[model samples]
Target: MSLVLDNVSYRYPGSTHGLHEVSLDVRAGELVAVIGPSGSGKSTLLKLVSGLTTGHTGRIVFGGQDMSAMPVHQRRMGMVFQNYALFPHLSVLDNVAYGLKLRKVPVAERHRRAQELLGIVGLSGYAQRGIGQLSGGQQQRVALARALAIDPQALLLDEPLSALDASVRGHLRDEIRAIQQRFGATTLLVTHDQEEALVMADRVAMLKDGRLLQIATPRELYEQPASRAVAEFVGLSTILPCTVCAPGRVDLGFAELHAHTGSRPVGTVLHAMVRPEHVRADPAPGSVNRLQGRTGAQRYLGALTRYDFEVPGAGKPFLAESARPAAEAIAIAPEHIRLLDL
Candidate 1:
């Protein structure tokens, strides 16, 4: 089974654009995350997949059938929202069994299936408790159980853990991954949270202005982003302006460094991006691209320290960070220079 979008795009009748020529394929039993800014159309893509909206251009194919032609209910998709969406008056067991009941499963069989799912989600003992009595984490487990009761063809999550407290969200994130693995259901998660996407997805599809920027594994997305927009959006990057001086080498005011800018004509102005952790302080002499900066301040972020430095050679100071929380930054000589591209 597969969920595929072939040049699918949508726009409000009079609006400019929603999604632009987006295409992707999620194989069975894989978890795909769609992440972007608030208005980047992640939610809108979810709606189209779940059959909540139609009449758009291009084709949305699910299990070899066009989804736009199918009714929402017949699509066999399970949706979980940020809110648990459980009925307050209903017991956890009853809430988990709601979808099964609607499908006319036998009462005994429904309870049997619901109990099994609850166990898988680690909420076995709280099945009969009222929704009001369960904590937010427990409520979310109940919601997961309910979604699984029908053995949905595809699981769709819309900002699934956004409502929970930080600690609870962490616990649920692991649980969600476990549940997805256990069920082997194709899943699509819609979220604006970059950490969630990076941690949860088998592959992440980054969006911007309703367009798919890049889709790749977490490692690929972080290490080899396709464009500047992607490089900045996916992680912390220090953008440096540079003039291409020669093949594989560029000059920053401090020194010249080696780089790979891929066949750009000479004299082209370009920017070089390096992850914060890649920027080192106090390098040795003959370093690739060494520049001196002032030790502005250090901020301890639990496990790492963010270093603020003033690059004197460059008119505007640049930022660098490190995992160690030293009172002062490492001393860099000419050898510690990494690259001179900007």
Candidate 2:
């Protein structure tokens, strides 16, 4: 089912920032992730869609009907929370079938449906195990199976695998994505972890101060952010102030280099953003955009090593990623640089 939010705005009576005219759309069978820092309205947005919070301006349409008038129970949304939210005393089968039981499904049929879902989630033989007897990751699986038991039109996940260890979380992230795709279910996931959002979602919606900043594919969000905050949220990018010299170039204090102006005319103040991977270390002598900066920090990431270097126009040190540590002075190519409105 497709979900749409049009000009939705919400605010608690005493709060300063609540959602501010946020709009987003999730196509059928697509997984969209809502990611932001704390109090950015990621969870609140989900709550509004799920009918947990009401009395908001604007319309929420899902499955071709207005959702503002619907209650949570009638929304047909299966929700999996961060803590799993299972009944401690219930067996795995019973937990998965709880929704069916509420609707007065026959005892035998509910068990059959629950067992089938457990198999789909790769827990075929654990039907009799109690929630307390399972590991955290296993509990999460049960939560997912339970949510899908009703064959919901939309699935809402709130950090579904966050309670598990790093390795378990990594594995379950793939599992959840696989299961979601296999079922062709429309899903909305809310998470603070950037990797989860970037890896799992078809499109990522970034929020800031209760406002929707940008919604785009992962590559677009990472490669070309709409604003400085969006750039910082996605990943590390070296931002340096520049004066627009012309349509395709900007002037740094010590040197002028090619940059993307987006047709902003001369004398406009802009910020040049170059990703760490684009920052070339010890380029050929006399290469364009070369600057003498002191390298002070060394960070050994698993796939890439990062070194911080002080650039001329940038007040703060900028990072460069390489196979190994780099020299102090570095040069970033103009083609790899993107100019932002700042």
Candidate 3:
């Protein structure tokens, strides 16, 4: 079912930190990931949609039905929490079947469905195991199965994979996406991890200071961010203050560079943003947009090395990532320079 939030605003009684006039549309069978730093309203937005919190302004519609005032149970939303929230006292099978049991499904039928869901989550053999007996990954699988047991209209995941180890998190992230697709469930995933949002979401919504900043596909969000904040938050970027000097060109005080400025009037102040990957280290001789800079700091990431290239006269170092350490200079492609408002 399609979920829509229209001009939603909520304020805490005595605190200023809450969502404000935020609106989003999550298409049916589409996965939209909400990403932001702590206290950015990602969780608050999820809670509003899940009917966990109330007294908000504007409308929330799900499948063409007004759900803003609906109770939690009536929302028919399945939630998988960060902690897994599995019942320690109950067996895995019972945990999965608990939701169905609350709805008064026949014991035999719920068991059949629970067993089938366990098989779907690759936990068929662990059904009778106590929650304490299962690994964290396995426990998470059980939590997912429990959420799916109810055949929900929409699935809400609150940092579902954050508690697991890196390897387990990656594996389960893929698994969750696969299962979400298999069931064709409309999903809203709240995450503080930008990589998780970029990897799993069809579109990512960025929030800051309890407000919606931008929402776009991963590629668009990364390559063509709407503002300086979005660009900085989504990935490693070097944002230099510049003034539009001419069509397809900008002046960065220290140097003049060719860049795409679209139709921005000349002399308009903007920030030139470029990702680390787009910055070329040790470029070919006579390359366009080449600059002389000393390498300051080097970080050896597993697959690539990140170099902090300290350009003369530029206030901050331009981050560049390459397979090997950088030399004394770097180049940024003109086309890769994204212009954003100050």
Local distance difference test scores for all models: 0.81, 0.89, 0.93
TM-scores of the candidates are 0.92, 0.96, 0.98
Candidate 1 wrongly placed segments (more than 4 Å):
252-255, 325-342
For model 1 the TM-score comes to 0.92
Q: Write down the worst ten-residue block by lDDT for model 2.
A: 324-333
Q: How accurate is candidate 1 locally (lDDT)?
A: 0.81
Tens digit per residue, CA lDDT, model 2, 57-150? 9999998899898889899999999888999988999999999999899999999999999998899999999899999999999999999998
Best by TM-score: 3
- The TM-score, computed over Cα atoms with residue i paired to residue i, of candidate 2 is 0.96
Each candidate structure's count of clashing pairs: 24, 0, 0
RMSD (CA, angstroms), candidate 2: 1.4
Error of 3 at 193 (Å): 0.7
Q: What is the C-alpha RMSD of each candidate to the true structure, in Å?
A: 2.9, 1.4, 1.0
